[model samples]
Target: MALEQLSEVIQRCQALPENSYTSEDYDLFTVAGRTCIEEGNSLQLLSIVLDEKNQEIVQCMGWNLLPPLVQVLLKKENKDLPHCLAVFNHLIEVCRPKELLIGLLEQLEHDDPDTTAESLHVLLTPLQKLLNLGVRKASSLGMALSSVLEQLCKLPVPETTEQEQDDVFSLGQCCSELSAFIQPFVEEAQHNHIRGKDSAQMMGDLPHNEDELRTELLKCMQVLSRLLLGVQLRDMDTLPESPLRDFASSILIGDSLPALVHRPLLRHRHIPGFLEEEVRYPKESLACIAHLLFVHHLLADMFPTVYQELYEKTLVRVEDCGLPVDLLEIKSFLSVPQNLVKVMTICPHQNLRSKGLKVFQLSIDKFNTEAKYKFFLMLKTSNHSGVEGYIIKNIKNQIDSALKAEGGNVWFEGLHLLPLLRSVLMLPDGPETDLLQYMDIMESLNLLRYLVIRDKTGIWTELYKIEDTFLKPLRVGINMSRAHYERELLITKEDKKTKAKVSVGDEKLPNMTTDTHIKALHSALHTFDMIESVLVRIEELVD
Candidate 1:
């Protein structure tokens, strides 16, 4: 086409309403995009028309075309590529195709430092949005990111000048964007690999460019650690677990993560003349390592079995190294609950109980009684509330003794012990009458009335009826306990199990159905009625 005719076409295309960029009209935008690149004009004008400042354009283009634009830009190679780069940058920030953007980032490995650096900045800008979009399809994006990281690893590390060494150590602000962009992918890849899946093979392809890949991976990991640490103040459960969880866990358990985290870089240290300052590189590295370990522990807590395995693994190491048992006791305690419960029920190992109790004691010392109480309360509120209650009361006596040395602040802590008590009361009656009586003792000591009163009025009324005479007594008891109960009750041997049992004459198990048995049948019928009523209420509520 003649230049004048092409200009006319371009202008005509631009003049069309944004809706013109439909799937059927995508070819027009593609041609325009290419033509602008050839003519060294900003394709950003077309992108802006198609992407930003025009929702209709985006709707018309459909979501899929966004990736094609990125694919075209990444595949095309042009030095002094101002228009293409500008358009590419604009497209990333505006109409991001998460997988495609990630794929484009892989090209950073092939680009020079200046281009790679610029691309890195563009890539990092929309990362949180990309992650939020949940693009975990294991696209070619993973391999591409791994490649770019490999290139960074190959960058020659400059010798630190004494003055530079004295400054606060940072992972270089320029690399920050690149680091952030690659962190999640790296984590995802690592997780896939650890799970014995080939989904992470993309990351493995960069070993040929080992130095660059390794350096970039470390930088990405550091950025992730910082990001996670900043947000750690929020509830840990809210954070998504990616491969980074395993990466951190491996280091904490003295696994392969330390080597990966401390991989050698090309940077060198330099000493300045007449300076008395010593650069604390190792210290900073150790601090980062500790932070990573903490993150790993937080992740492991979500999976009790995994936490137990990792903890036991750590204990074996501590024993082999002749390390002070007390030094690692806290981690062991944190990891041992799952194992301790198994031991208590399955094998009844004395050693396990002793060690578990010792660890619990240490936890009480390290954290105030309030912290331990809250921690146990949280456990009771988790999905395993039933099991946690069983374990806590079994060790309640020891816990009480530990708290008593601090002047009995356990009950006053008021850490919402209701969930635990409710779980106990709901335990199925069988050969477990002793367990029931034990629960009764804890309830009496801890004042179950607080829980009953604090409960939702609707639920409380539905659950139990108070005789007019009992109401005043119950309210008075609750208030008295709320004001004066400074220490939780200590469970003694008698509290652990009751002597109550069914005597043959009193109520033959195979024959007589006594008043107690008849009352249970009535309770079951009442419960069924309540459930049917609640379901009807739920249906009404939905309507």
Candidate 2:
């Protein structure tokens, strides 16, 4: 175990040819390996063995030294730690990259968290080096990267398991490694010249170029899509706090994600048509990106700068190519009405919200009666006044459509129509609710008025249920709100008069203005009065 033993192993290794080593030589080399840490000259020994002239030593005993080098690395106080790391780096060049990578991956599962973390942390350099190896020393790594992503997709979210701290640390490290692993290939693929036909090379060797890089990128994204598409970020704002929830929130609040996300849309002044093809590469990428932005609010920002940039960029491309995808439709996540509703409800941008509304209006009719019915129910739960109002209006439209001679009345007629009608007829938080805050109540009233006037025959059988379940409560609520607001209005007027008399000054202070307050109260009173009249008309029509 002395330095001389390592020296003897080195001398014996230098005298042998590649693949010509006997069992005796390997035995001697294994016997001398302990000196790497025991001699206190680990760095010097590592330096000597890493020399170009000692390829024989490295080829013969490089993997053999990995165990002891990691042992040295685990020693917090080891002075030769940095030297050991340098040797590990050199070992990557001499040993097969896959073998070195597999060794690191194995260490990541160690029962001791510190060991798992160090193993994960150390993976960064070797991964980068292995990726940088390109096709020179290895074939396409698309499959390997895919396998790694599959494993990452299975890592238990932090705080959900007994290993809370370990889970968080490991997940954080994995996210870092995931970012580092994909960035180079993503950045490289940004160039149009390197962009090739989109195909997923899931298995087998391919030439290292746009084809291979993109295959690797696609496989990784496919894994991510499987993991992410199954998640519902639509109600992330309401989700109970958890490590995964917190992580998703952090991503939403943070600045834009790196090239893996925005770069595809941001890089090109004008993207090709294939970017939106039905095929995999960009489609999977786009699907994941859209899911992140729409459902998870991953890219949503208060200022809309990121949304603005991406929207403008993609808009230009869409207009240029006449691509079927529209940013307005949120075409990526638009397949699900809930996702679109989530984006429209929570998006901060006024223009995007308006555009989303337009898209929702145009697309709502495209769904069958059943889907539209379900979507109406979904919108009611949004708790958003505009969304509620919009859905209520749609409910009225569907009933009107069913009444038309040519309209099939498939699911929007008779009993099928009652469920849709009931979804919009009820007051949110009951009639005593803040009517102004729940403007959708007026839309509900209008819908009721339309139904009573247009199709009372269809719903006559259910009128009692409607009145008892929806109208009676609404009537009580409206009356209560009316009296409450009238009292507030009377008090507000009296207060204003007193303030006017007390103010001896000619000019009024900004805070002294009660006109806006009075107008708000009058508006509330007017709304309640209008709702009462609708109730009266319905009662009269039924009588």
Q: Best by lDDT, which number?
A: 2
**Cα RMSD for candidate 1?**
22.5
Which parts of model 1 are misplaced by more than 4 Å? 1-28, 37-40, 43-90, 93-99, 111-114, 137-141, 162-171, 182-543
lDDT of each: 0.40, 0.61
For model 2, what is the C-alpha lDDT against the true structure?
0.61
Q: Which pairs, if any, clash in model 2?
A: 431-477
Residue 45 lDDT in candidate 1: 43
Tens digits of per-residue lDDT for model 1 on 1-543? 323443444455456775454443465545654554455444444445444345444333323334434434545555425555555444444554654444445444444554544444444544434544544433333344445455544333222232123212222333444545555655655554454434336457422222222232333343333333332221235334323334344323322444434643434323222111211124344555554444345434433333332334445444321433344347655555545544443444455456555553333334433445544554453333334544455335433453455535443223343343344334233222232222332333232333343332122432342222222333343344433322222222222233234346786354233444445545544433443343344334323
RMSD of 2: 15.8
RMSD of each: 22.5, 15.8
Residue 68 deviation, candidate 1, in Å? Answer: 14
